[model samples]
Target: MTDSTAERRHELSSFLRARRERTSPSDVGLPGTPRRRTPGLRREELANLAGISTTWYTFLEQGRDVRPSLQVLTAIADALRLGEPERAHLIMIAADETHPGEDSEYLAPEVADVPKMVNPNPAYVTGSSYDLLAWNDAAVELFPGAIDAAKPNLARWIFTNPAARDALPDWPVVAQGLLARLRTNAGKHPGSPRFQRLERELRTSSPEAEAWWPRYDIATSQAGAKRVRSRSGQEQLMTYASFHVSDQPEQILTIYRPA
Candidate 1:
């Protein structure tokens, strides 16, 4: 098997095990017993819940060369009581599905102009890995030094930059959300060099990233409100939404307006 395939299998195995251990029997409507030694539902219990053989499920958890159909995976997801994001992440890794716009990195001039068009609002365009591809004056004012960096990545800035804590009033919560989104993206693009490098940098530089990486959290980016401190140290509530570039799906245009 290729290195990427092996790495993906390992990730799949680890993610499954983590989710399984966190899911309690009571959570799945199974009677809980004090006699249970395992942290959560037993392997056989999960297998039965999913209508699969215990041995097969065990092999899958062990990262054996077992190919599970989509239907089976769905059944297992239901048994595990995984959320939508978690279910999508599981399917992406287990089935080794290729993400859309995995190789394309070309950003059209028109697409790059989107942020500037959204004048007064803090707007920026990011690549699939959250790299700051383009930003407007408002965005620069909102995020000082970030847009000026040689390789400005949102995730990297959130985790490694000390200024991020001051800029974001709720830094921990925001960081976790960003990390979860990154995790979901990582699942979609397994063995991506850019992602690998970013993960390594985060884990090495930030204690929170190191501790949270193994949790295997997954999240889809969504419209939300955030409290940001401007360069004047004035706190402001902003509503943010992201739009996918029609032609280049990997390029995301995010705009923040006063809430």
Candidate 2:
């Protein structure tokens, strides 16, 4: 009923609508509706599938005084075909019933489900915000002393850690790309604690990082063609590919192929 609450509800409504539209009828085992007025499920059909009343669903979507229950939120989330983050957003909104008039931040962690990277090619998959979630065997072997899953961070390794200076044959190329990409993440997630921690650690540990952290930018490591020097002193250049499992949007799968 408050302006901020109304605004957040409106935003949530728009998000739900957009996500619903993005899903096709076949995706949810629904028959295609040639005569359907909208591109996806109608509000009534969705409410029916969610087992909630049409009026309640409509009130929720309309940014009214509708306090959604966990069950109801789950139902709506499923009906809307929301991803985990989206589902989390719905849960947060529904669970905060006591504070009806207050707005909420619903951004789910971008790194919540990043895939476990493994294998012979040196590669890593980070969040859309560039938090290093996982890396492969080759990446570990090449970088040696870099990935401490206990402390796995690409930016920290490239900048703060000294091994990178020796591990990288072309430090500037690797370093620049990394810094630039991290700069980009910073811009998108300025208030992110994980990002702040990484930035703080880098600043305290590396001089180059301190200099670059302030120039926030928005870049992510996706598909990049690059090479590395193998332990045998041979240059092993390779192209890397990143995969985002459709079923697991939060997890990013990065695979490396030796070229």
Candidate 3:
């Protein structure tokens, strides 16, 4: 007997979540009830809209024993009002496909254009995984050796680079959070060239990093206070707000404000 495996079921689950939360009943043509217990559409409602059975929708959301056809996936995508990037992400996740080559060149200029003039507060843009791709003068000045686009990557610097150790005062606390995020990304993109490159780079560069890498077990980063030591001897603790750039699939906008 052969064991059937689930593929892209996680992606389908993710797509379902992102879809339902994005639309309220009023946003679509569905009736809104103040007494409704669920925050978003019920499984029955989603099935009704997608022209499928509630049991089938439950299986899809449960990520159980399902290999949805492209036509069916397209129907779900359309029903969810998914934009191009969101649609593509749903498709890729469902297929369990990897796009490392496309993923590598993140932080396109259009996604987060550098200001003609630098601001007082330090800021930068990275990929979805917080891989620092670009920063302005203020960001560069704030962390003397922080943004080196040529070999700049947040994960590598956080785990391997010593200069980064100095720039970020609370390394011990932040490293755990950062590595957990990398762990999740790695699972999604196993054997990817860039991911492998970063993994190897960290392993070779820091044995401490290698020891801790395998134990990481989380996907998202928490909005915690980040502190950095300034050259003048005081610490610059700040609030970091992370935003996803809608048009560019892999870009993020991060702004730092003084604490």
> What C-alpha lDDT do the candidate models reach, one value each?
0.86, 0.61, 0.66
Give the candidate order by descending lDDT. Answer: 1, 3, 2
TM-score for each predicted model, relative to the true structure = 0.93, 0.49, 0.59
Q: Is candidate 1 or candidate 2 better by lDDT?
A: 1
lDDT of 2 by residue, 38-127 (tens): 777777778887898988878887767767777778887787676664565556444432232111122234433332334454556555
RMSD of 3: 9.6
lDDT of 1 at 16: 88
Count of clashing pairs, candidate 3: 0
True-structure lDDT of candidate 1: 0.86
TM-score for candidate 2, please give it: 0.49
Ranking by TM-score: 1, 3, 2
Looking at candidate 3, the ten consecutive residues that score lowest on lDDT are 1-10
**Backbone clashes, candidate 1:** 0
Cα RMSDs, all models: 2.1, 12.7, 9.6
Candidate with the greatest lDDT versus the true structure: 1
Model 1 Cα lDDT, one tens digit per residue, 98-216 = 43334336788998898889899999988878888889999988877677788788889999988899899999999999898888777667678778888899999999999998888
